[model samples]
Target: MKKIILLLTLITLVFSSMPVNEAVAKSKYKKISVSATAYNELGRTATGFDYRKHPTAKAIAVDPRVIPLGSKVYVPGYGYAIARDVGGRIKGKIIDVHFKTRKQAIKWGRKKVKIRIYRK
Candidate 1:
């Protein structure tokens, strides 16, 4: 009857709309060092950097295959970071923490810190 046809059609539509994971792939998880920096308030005026731009002590680099670019990460010692850049200077599982001032950056300089990757 009409009711039976409508139910089947709705079911088919729902299933078809479900996400197929063929195109996008998941990143492999890994633990790595992370650093922190605190940026000056002036640096954040133009682009809303305070909220969006990586925090001065919040920028970090990660292995692209392991963490991917633009991923949010939390550091055990330093706090939160966004994987923004890859470094020739930084190799293996190392991460560079950014800060607003030289003093703040230096305060956190070159510490071995654990990082947790936040999956979106």
Candidate 2:
């Protein structure tokens, strides 16, 4: 029984010491042009995460066909954000960024921006 326990402990240690694959740890992204807008809604996003209490400031609404949900994206003027929300008029190549206030959202207005989207 003691020998069996020691072997099991050794096996566990070996498995835990193994390195994770770099490819799996890193994400590959593609660049695309999108029309960007801003919003300040304080409710839950389409991902079921509260917009007011989300962990990252990088939250944006995206069209599923253009950029899938949960994708990490880097918007030029908006910085880095995750595609966590969607909108009715946000179809095609349009994206909506989230802000803390309506004034900030309005300040962004509408413009064309280059965004890098991570491929799942």
Candidate 3:
């Protein structure tokens, strides 16, 4: 609907407005160790990221206090994604990576990995 488009547009604007010295991705990120989990649920996210709707969009749920919303994060096994969602259980030093399928989410399971966070 119009709301979805507007939300996506607003989120894009917010994420794009971040200040980064390096244009190349993963160049200016703060590396940190955290517990990473996976999820493939279809619902409304805290930041309005709907995997069912925008399946191709890379997104992650993070603790806003720790990683902040709109931050670009790079996972070890996974590729780069944006911190476009938040979860109640996702507290400090923990993150939830979004996958397209439950099988993929289950496959990912849980792991302790070093992630690169790019503030924006």
Candidate 4:
């Protein structure tokens, strides 16, 4: 009788834990087109100095539906970008790449690229 009760309790615990694990693993993720801008570190002080702390290169925008804000994405052509800001003009499957310098960013201009979303 005691063994039977213990077995039932253990089974209940195991089943209860499954749903949480599945929800995390099954979090929706998808691929989208990305563009890159490469830039050298400049114009940081002029921007007020806080922005200078991190890499001069910044990721302007990405499709929020495809990649959530604050998520880190790896772009095939453009190294890596953190989904920072969104663009009103940019909608659907498009992303705006940011760079430290206008020269590099413009050089990259616009190009179709692939991005992989890293989920925790």
Best by TM-score: 3
lDDT of 4 at 109: 73
lDDT of 2: 0.87
Model 3 residue pairs with clashes = none
Task: Indicate whether candidate 1 or candidate 2 has the larger lDDT.
Answer: 2
| Residue 69, candidate 4: alpha-carbon lDDT | 75
TM-score of each: 0.52, 0.73, 0.74, 0.58
Error of 2 at 52 (Å): 2.9
Best-performing candidate as measured by lDDT? 3
Error of 3 at 103 (Å): 0.3
lDDT of each: 0.60, 0.87, 0.89, 0.64
Name the lDDT of candidate 4.
Answer: 0.64
Candidate 4's residue-wise lDDT over 1-120, tens digit each? 999999999999999877666556775545665554333443332224334566564554756776677777777767676777666656766777667667877788777777777663
**2 or 3: which has the higher TM-score?**
3
* Model 2 TM-score, 2 decimals: 0.73
Q: For model 3, what is the alpha-carbon lDDT of residue 19?
A: 77
Residue 46 alpha-carbon offset, candidate 1, angstroms: 19
Q: If ranked by TM-score, best first, what sequence of candidates would result?
A: 3, 2, 4, 1
Q: Which ten residues in a row have the lowest lDDT in candidate 3?
A: 20-29
